[model samples]
Target: MDLIQRLDSRDADFASQLSRLLAFEAEQDESIDRAAADILADVRRRGNAALIEYTNRFDRMTAASIDDLEIPRADWHAALAALPTAQRNALEAAAERVRIYHERQRSETWTYTEADGTMLGQQITPLDRVGLYVPGGKAAYPSSVLMNAIPAKVAGVAELIMVTPTPDGTRNPIVLAAAAIAGVDRVFAVGGAQAVGALAYGTETLAAVDKIVGPGNAYVAAAKRRVFGTVGIDMIAGPSEILIICDGKTPADWIAMDLFSQAEHDELAQSILLCPDAGFLEDVRAAIERLLPTMPRADILRVSLANRGALILVRDLQEACDIANHIAPEHLEISTEAPEVWAARIRHAGAIFMGRFSSEALGDYCAGPNHVLPTSRTARFSSPLGVYDFQKRSSLIQVSQAGAQTLGRIAAELAYGEGLQAHAASAEFRLDKP
Candidate 1:
C-alpha cells in the first residue's frame, strides 16, 4: 500500500484532485449530538447536582459535591512546587514568553475629538470571565494550559476558570503547575459536554463565563457550537495540518520528520509536501519509509500519511506559493534557501514557519506565539487565538449639537430609504430647524 499519495500539478485534474484531498466534512454525529444535547439540558436544569453526577460517571471520580471537585489555589501552588526543577522552569519560562507576546497584542481604548467637539473611537475592554477547557488524563497538555490561559490573562480578563477531566481521580501535576504559572483563577475536575454546559449556563457552584476557549473532543465541540449565542467561543477547529514548500535543498530526513510531527497528532491530521524537484520528492519519501519505523506513534503516523498526506510536484516555487494560498493550511513551512522570499508570496496561512529550523513544534510550545490556530481552511478568514479573542470592543460616539445637525440629515435620508419610519423620525428629531 502506498504510504502517501503523489500528485503532479501539471495534470489536467490536479485542481479537482487537490480539492478532494482537502475536503473534510465535519459532519455532526447523531449519537454524539443527542448525547451532548441531553447532557447540556440536564446540567442546565440540575446545576451543581448534575455536574457532580456527570463528573462521577464520565471521569470515574467519586466526588459528592461541587466543592470536592474544585482545586484551590493552594493545590495549584503545591503542584508547581512539587514539579521537578526542570519541568517547573520550563513551564514558567513558556508562560512568561506567552504572556510577553500577548501583551504586545493587547488593545487599548482610544478616542479622538473633531473640531465640532464630537468624539468617536473605540473602547477595548477585557471580558469579565473566561473558561478554558483542557484535555486531561493520558492526553494532559501543560502547553495547552499555558497557550490558552496566558493570552486571556494578558488581555486582563478578571477571572479565568479551567476545566479538565481527571479520570480515576488522578490529577496531572504538570497541568496544575502550568495553571499556576499562567495565573488561572480557578480549576475544576470536570470535562466533556457537561463541563461545557456548566460553563455556558450558570450552575449553583460555577458562575457562567462570558466566553469559552480551548480545544476539546467531539462532544465538547458540539456543545460549544450549540451554545455559541449564549456564550462566545473560539473557532471550532478541525484536525491538525501542515504544508511544507521545500526547495528540495533541505535534508530529506529533516523534511520527512517535519511532516511526521503533524501526522503524529492523529490519524485524521494532514501533512503535505510541495516541491519542484521530483528526485527530492523521492528522497523524502524514502526518508519517511526509513524513519517512520522508529517513531513511537508509528501506527498513527502511517494511517495519517496514507489517508490524508500527499507529496505534490509543482512547476516551481511560484506555483507552490499559489497552491498554498488555495489550501490555506493550518501550519505552513517554507524550507528553502531564502524562505523569506517565498514566505512573502503566501497571503493565507494560520501560521508560517519561516525556515527549515522553525519547526511547527516550536510554535506549538515556546515560540511566544499562540498555537491555537484556525484549521480546515478557515485560515482564509480566521486567525490564531490570542489576546484579541479575550477582549471586547465597543464603538464610542458622542455627537455635539452642531455635529448632530449634520449627521442627522444623512442618517434620516438613509433610514427613510430603508423604510424604517421610526429610525427616520428619531434622526429627524435631532436635526436643527431651518
Candidate 2:
C-alpha cells in the first residue's frame, strides 16, 4: 500500500493542493449542538440534581448526590502515594519542570507616573477559580492533568477543580496522582458536555468557575463552544499535527518514527515532512514501512498516515520554512545541522522542536513546555496554554486635575466625531474652563 502522498514544490497546483490538505472545517454538528444545548440548559435549570442524574446515566455510576462524586483531598494524596516509585518520580519531575517554566511567564503589575502627576499602568491578577476537564475511562491522560492544572496553580489560581468521567465506577490512579502533584483543589467523577455545563453554570454543590480548560470528545468541544460567552474556555482544538523540515541529514528511521508520533494520535491527525532531498524522502518512506508494523497502534497509525500524511519535495530548506509558516502546524520539528538557523525563519508554529535530537514527544511529556497548543493554523494568532491564560490584566488610570483638563478635550473631540453627544458632554464636563 502507498501509505503516504507525495508532492513537489514545483507543481503548478502545489499551493491549492496544500490548501485543500490543510482545510479542516469544524462545522457544527447539529446533533451534538442540540444535545449540548439541552444539557447546558438542564444543568442551568436543575443544578445539582441534573448533575447527579446525568452522572449516573452517562458515566454508569450510581452516585446519589454531588457529594458522592467528589474525590476528597485525602484520596488524591493516597492516589499519589499508591503510584509506583518510577511513575511517581516521573510525574513529580514533570510537574516541577512545568512549574518552573511557567513561573517565568508570570506577569507582574507595573505603573509609570506622567509629568502631570497622572498614573497609568496595568495590574495583573489570577482567576479566582478554574475548571479542568480530563477525559476519563480508557483515555486517561495524566500528562493533560499536569499541563492544565500546573499553569493555573503557578498563576496563583485560588481554586482549581477537575472533573473526569469514570465509566463503570472505574478510576485512573495515574490521573489522580497528577491532580495531586499539580495541586488541584478538588476532583469529581463527572465528564462530557454536562460537566462543562456544570462548570460554566455551577451546580448547587459546585461553584461556577471563571474559565474551563482541557480537551475532550466532540460533545465536550461543542459544549465548550456553546458556553464560551458565559465562561472562558481554552481553544477549540482540532486534530493533532506535526510538520517536520528535514535537511536530509537526520537518520531516516528517526524521521519516520517522529512522523508516526503524531499520526498515532488519531486517524484525522496530520503528519507531513518537507525535505529537499528526494532520496532522503524515499529512505524515510522505506523506514516508515519497516517500523510501522511494530507500533502498538499500527492500525490507527496506518490510516492516519495513508489519509493525512505527506512527503513533500521542496526546492530547498527556505521553501520548506515558507510552507511550514503557511500550515502553522501544532508541532514543528526542524531536523537539520543548525535547527535554530531555520527555526528563526519560522513565523508561525505552536511549538518548535529544534535540532535533530529534539523530539515532539518531549514537549508532550516533560520538556517543560505546555503540550496544549493552538491547532489548525491557529498558531498564526493563538499561543500555547500558559500562566497568561489563567491571569487577567486591568488597566490603571489616575488622572490629576491638570491631566484631566488636558485629556478631556481629546476625549470630547473623539466622542463628538462619533456623534455620541452624551459621551462628548461627559468628557467636556471634566474639562476646566480656559
Candidate 3:
C-alpha cells in the first residue's frame, strides 16, 4: 500500500510468471476432446435422441420432443412485456448503434474484366444459417445478443439460430427479450457441449449451422475446439484481459478500478499497467492495494494480478507501446496525455479505449463494436466476431480462349514443378486446343 513497497522490485519475476500464466492456453483436459467426440458422434448417429439425453444429463432438464427444444413464440412476447420500459429502450438504442456500425462492415459482390476478356472478381455470400451461443449464467448480456446477431442480420444470413442453457429449464426474460429485439429466427433451450453438438451436427430439432459464434465456459470452449472441423467456430477465446498505458495525468484510483473490472471476470483474467513515470506507477500501485480490500472479487483479482497481471515500469511511453504489441492483449486502454497517439501506435488488440474518459465498460455495452473479442494473444492474428464471420467469400474467375492460353502456361509449369501431372494436364489440355 505504501509507495516504497509499491515501487519495490520484489516481484521482478514477471517474465517467468507470464510464461506460466499464459500456459493456461492448454489448460483444458485432453479428455474434453474425447467427450466432445463422443457427443458429436452421438448427435450424428442418434440425432434428436442424443440431444434429449444430453439435455437431461448436462442441462438437468428433459426435452420430451423436438417441440420442447424450441422456445415458444408466446414466451418471447412475455419476456418483452416483462422488461421495464427504460431497459427496453436502452436495448433498442444499443441495437441501432450496433446495426449502424456493422452495416459498414457488410461486403458486396464485384467483378472486373481484363483486356483479353478474362473476367475475375469475388462473389460474397452470406451463410445460409448460423448458430450463436449465449452464456446463460452469471449475467445476461443483451449487448452480446446484439453484437452477434446484428452482424449476421447485416450479412444477410437467412436463419440465425441461437442456443442458451437455463439451469431451471426456464429462460431468462431479458435474454429472450434481447433475442426478439435482435430478430433471431430460432431459440433453443440447450446449453454446454450438447448445444454445440446440436448446432454442429444437426439434430432432428436443430439444423446444422455453417458457423458457430459466441462466448462460453471451459466446457463450451473445449467443445468448440473439438468440433472445429465439423463446423466453423469464431475463436477459441480465453479469459478476458485489459492492459492500460497511463501517465501521471490519470488518477491512480481510476486506473486501479479499470484494471479490476477485467480481473473480476475470473482468477486467470489479466490486468496489466505499463507506464513510464515511476512516481505514477507507485501511486497506481497504492490505489490497487487500497482498493483491493474493498472489492467483492478481491480474492479473484489478487490471484489474477499475482498470476498474469503486473504494474510494469517501462523506460518510456514508447517502450510501453512496444511491450503492448508483444503481449497483444484483448483490450488496450491508453490513459496518457495523448491517448489517440498511443492508440494509433497500437498494432494489435481486440479493442482499444483511448483517453481517460473512454472507459473499457463503454465498449462492453453501449459502444457499437462487438465485445466478443480475441483473447489469450489471439488478437495478433484474429479479429472480433462481426458481419464477416457470418459471410463467406469465393473468388470469381472467367477466361476466354486467349486469356486461358496466356495464363495456362504458367499454371501448367507450376503444377509440373510440384510433380502434379494431373493438375498440369488439366491446364495444358485447355491451352493445347488452340
Q: Would you estimate the TM-scores of all the predictions?
A: 0.98, 0.98, 0.92
lDDT digits (tens) for residues 3-119 of candidate 1: 999999999999999998998999899999999999999999999999999999989899988999999889989999999999888888888888889899999999999989999
Task: Give the distance in Å from residue 159's predicted Cα in candidate 2 to where it truly belongs.
Answer: 0.7
Runs off by more than 4 Å, candidate 2: none
Clashing pairs in 3: none
Superposed by TM-score, candidate 2 places the C-alpha of residue 356 at a distance from the truth, in angstroms, of 0.9
lDDT of 2 by residue, 278-315 (tens): 99999999999999999999999999988889999999
TM-score of 1: 0.98
Worst 10 residues of 1 by lDDT: 87-96
> Ten-residue segment with the worst summed lDDT in candidate 3?
1-10
Candidate 3 regions with alpha-carbon error over 4 angstroms: 1-25, 31-33, 415-425, 428-434
